[model samples]
Target: MKSKKEKGIKYFLKKLGPGNHYPKAILYLMLVFSIPATVLNIGSDIAGMGAVSNLLIPAIPSFVFSIVFTTVLTITIIKFSYQQIAGILKWLCLSVLLYIIVPFFIKVNWMDVLKHTFIPTIKFDQDYIEILVALLGTTISPYLFFWQATMEAEDVKHKIKAVVVDKQMLRDVKTDVNTGMFASNLVMFFIILTTGIVLHGNIKDISTVDQAAKALEPVVGKLSYVCFAIGVLGTGFLAIPILAGSLSYIIAETFDWKQGLDKHFGEAKGFYITIVISLAIGLVINLTGINPMKTLVYTSILYGVTAPVMIAVILHVCNNKKVMKGHTNSLLSNILGFITLIVMTVSAVMLIYFSLHH
Candidate 1:
C-alpha cells in the first residue's frame, strides 16, 4: 500500500502531464513568438553567409541557398529518425570552435575585456535595457527547459515504468543539462570576445548576423568573413530544429497527442503539423521585410517576460519533497535558484519601466 505522500505525488505528477505539460503551455506561447525570431535568425545566417560565399565563389544567390536550405532541413527532419538527428547535432558542435579560434587570430585589449567582463558597466538607456533583457532571454530560454525535460522523459520511457526518479537518475539529469548549458555559454562568450576585439566600435551597428561576422573581416581578412558566415549557418541549423521541435513537443503534450521525433509523420501528424506551422510562420516573418536581428532581440524580451514565472514554478517543484523526494534541492541550489529569480525579476521590471517611460 502506498503512503499518503506517495499517493499525493502521483496525483500531482498526473496533473502535470507529460513533462510538466501545464507549465509548458506558457512556454509554448513564448515559442510561438520565438518561432518567427528563429526564422529570422535562420534567414539572416543564410543571407549573411551566402553573400560572403558569393563574393568569393560567385556560384549562387542567397535566395537559392535559403530555399535549398529550408527544403533540405524539412526533408531531413521528416525523413530521419531521432537518433540520426542526434548524430547531426553532435557534428554541429564543431561550428562553435570557429568562434573560439577567431579570438586567437585577432588582437585584443585584454585589460579592457577583463574589466568589462568582471567589473561590468551599468547602462540605463532603452536600447541597453532591451539588449540586457534579450541576452537574459536567449541565455536561459524557456524552450530549453521544455526540451531538456521532455528528452529525459523520452530516454526513460523505454525502460522505466515507475513514477519516481532515483537520486542517481536526477544527478545524471543535472549533469547532462548543465553540460549543454555550459557549452552554450562558452560559445556565446567567445563570439562576444571575437566581436569586441575585431568589431566593437569599428561597426556602428550589426543589423544582421552576417554583418556581425563581416565585421571580423578587417581583423583576420576575408577568411574571418567566410568562417563567421559558415559559423552562423551551422549555429542556425542546430538551433532551428530545437526551436521547431520544442514547439511541437509542447503543443503535442499539451493536447495529449502522440509525440516523438522518432515517430513517422503518419504516426504523429499533429506533432509534425505543429512543426510545419511554426516554420511556415517563421518564414512569413522573414519575407515581411522585418529586420531579423531586431526580431531576434525583441523575441528575447518576450522570453524575459515569461521566464521568471516559469522559473518560480520550477523552483517550487525542485524544493518540494513531493516532487523531488529525497532529491529535493540542496541549500546551495535553492540559494542560486533564488538569486536567478531575483536577477531575472529585476531585469524584467527594468525592461517594463524603460519601455513605458520611452
Candidate 2:
C-alpha cells in the first residue's frame, strides 16, 4: 500500500514536472495547507496573544465560518452595485474599489480593527499623504482603463448587440468607468485593513513574488502560503484579460480599426491579434530570466511620478461641461480627488529622495 502511494506521488510529480513551476507551486500550496491546515492554523491562533488577538476567537470555527459569510457579503455588495450602475458605470465603481486597500483575511478583534481604521492615523510625515495616494493610484491602474475601453469596442463590433453607440452611449461608458473606479478603491481599502491588522508591520519590502506570498502566513496561519497563491491567482485572472485587452484597445483606437471582442475572429482579426501579441510580450517579459518584480517596482515609481499629470487629466475630463455633461463629478469627489493627488505628489518626491539616498 505504501509502495502504491509512493508510485502515485511519483506519477503526479512526473506529470507536473519542474518546468511547470507556477502550477507546481499552486499544487504544493494546496497539499501543504487545505481545510485541515486551516484547522491547524486555528490552534496556532489559539496560542495567540490571548484577548488582544485580531478577532476574538468567539470560537475557532467563527474565524473559518466568517470567511464564507464575508465572501458572500462582499460578492453581494458588488453584485448590487453592478446592477445599480446606470450602465457600464460599474467599471468606475470597480476602479474606486481597486483604490481601496486589500483586506488581509488574518484579522483579529475585527470590530476593534474597524474602529481603529475609522480613527484617523495621525502619522504627520510630509510623505504620508503621498504614500497613501500612491497606494490608491496603484488600484485604478492606467493599463486597466485602456484594457476596458478596448473590450467595450470589441463588444460593439460583434453582432452581440446590433447597435452602434451614439453620444448617449458615450455617457453610459463614462458612468461605467466611474463606477469601476469606485469598486477598485473599495477593494484596496479592505486589503490594507486586513493585512495591516494581521501583519502589523511584521514584514516589509517585498522583493520577490515569493516574499509577497510568504508574508501572508502570520495573518492566515499555515494556509497563509496557499491563501497568498489563491489571491495572486485570482488577481491574475482579472488582470491578464485587462493587460491583453488594453494593448488591443490602444492599437485599434490609434489605427481607427473596427476591432472588438464580440465580433467573430474573422470580423475582428486585428483586435484579437493585438490581444495575442500583448500576452506574448508579457510572457516574454516573464521568461527572459529578468526579475519581473524589479520591473514592477520601477513601473510603480513611474506611476507615482506621473500621477500628477494623470490626476489633472482625470479632473479636467471629469469636470468639463463638454465631456461629463450633467454627470460631472460631485464637489465632494473633486475635493477628495485633489487631496489624494496632492498626496501622490508628496509620495513621488519621497520616493525619488529615498531612491537617491539608497
Candidate 3:
C-alpha cells in the first residue's frame, strides 16, 4: 500500500511544466515582497550565531563579475541570433572549466591535489558522486525548460498581439536559440558558483532545495540572501507559471486545441485549466511538507538519469532545418555540444551502474 507521501511526490513530479507565458506580475510581486522579510530573518539567524568568524566570509567579486558578464551575454543573445549564442557558449564552457579546475593552485599542494583530482580514487568518489549527480541533473530541469519554452511562447504572443494591432511582422516568436542558450548559461553559472563554493571548500552534501537557498548566504554573504531569495522565490513564481504552462502547451498541442497566449483566458479554458492543475500540484509539493532538500535531491537524480535522451532531442531540434532554419549549430558548437552530451551520457551510465551494483 502506497503511503500518502508517496502519492504526493508522484503528483508533484507528474505535472510541473509551463506552457504559454510565465505570469510576470506574480514574479515581480514575489521579489518585491520577499526580500525585506528574508533579510530581516537572516539577520536574526546571524545575530544568534555566537561568533564573528562566520561573518568573516566574503563573496568573491570575480564571481559577481562573471555573473554580470553572463547577463551581458544574455542581452547579446536576445539582440543577435543563434550563431552569436554558440560563440559565446563555447567561451562560457571554457570559463566553466576555469571556474571548476583553476582555484586549487592558490593554496593546496598542486601536485597532490592533482593526484587526487585526476586519479579519482574509489573512496573519495563516493562522497563526490552525490553532488555530481545533483549538479548534472540540471540538464533536464523542468523549471528552466518551462521558463524557456513559455518565454519563447511569450515572445511569439507579444509579436502576435503587436501584429493584430499594427498588422505587420513586428516581431517573430520562432524559438530563438540564442535566447535559450543565454538562459541556459546563466543557470549553469549560478549552479557552478553554488557547487564550486561548497564542493571545492566544504565538500558537503546538499540534499535538498531549502539547503540550496541557505547556501547562498555563506557564498554571497549578508542581506544578499534577500536578493537570493527574491531571485529564487520570485523566479519560482515565474517558474511555477511556466511549470503549469508547459503542461498546458504539451496537452493542447497533443489534442490540437486552440491553444496560444494570444487567446484570452476565457477562450483558452483548457490551457488555463491545465496551468491551474499544474500549479496546484506544485503547491501541494510544499504543503505536503516533505523535506524540500530531499525532494530536490531525488528530483535531481531523476533528471540526471533522464538527461541523455533530452540532450539527443535538443541536438535533433537544433539540427533539423525545418525547426531551426538558419540558426543550425555550427561545426564547433556541434562538437562541443556533442562533448557535453557524451559527458552527461557517461555520467548517467555511471550513476545507473553504481545504483544497480549497490
TM-scores for every candidate against the unseen true structure: 0.85, 0.57, 0.54
lDDT of candidate 1 at residue 220, scale 0 to 100:
75
Q: Considering TM-score, which of the candidate structures 1 and 3 is the better prediction for this target? A: 1
RMSD of each: 4.8, 18.1, 15.1
Model 1, residue pairs in steric clash = none
Local distance difference test values of all predictions, in order:
0.71, 0.47, 0.46
Name the candidate, 1 or 2, with the larger lDDT value.
1
In Å, residue 310's CA in model 1 sits off its true spot by 1.8
Candidate 3: 10-residue stretch with minimal lDDT = 44-53
Q: Considering TM-score, where higher is better, how would the candidates rank from best to worst?
A: 1, 2, 3
Could you give candidate 1's per-residue lDDT for residues 198-294 as a string of tens digits? 7566887888655765787787786866776677678778877777787788778667797888789999999988877766665555555556566
Error of 2 at 31 (Å): 44
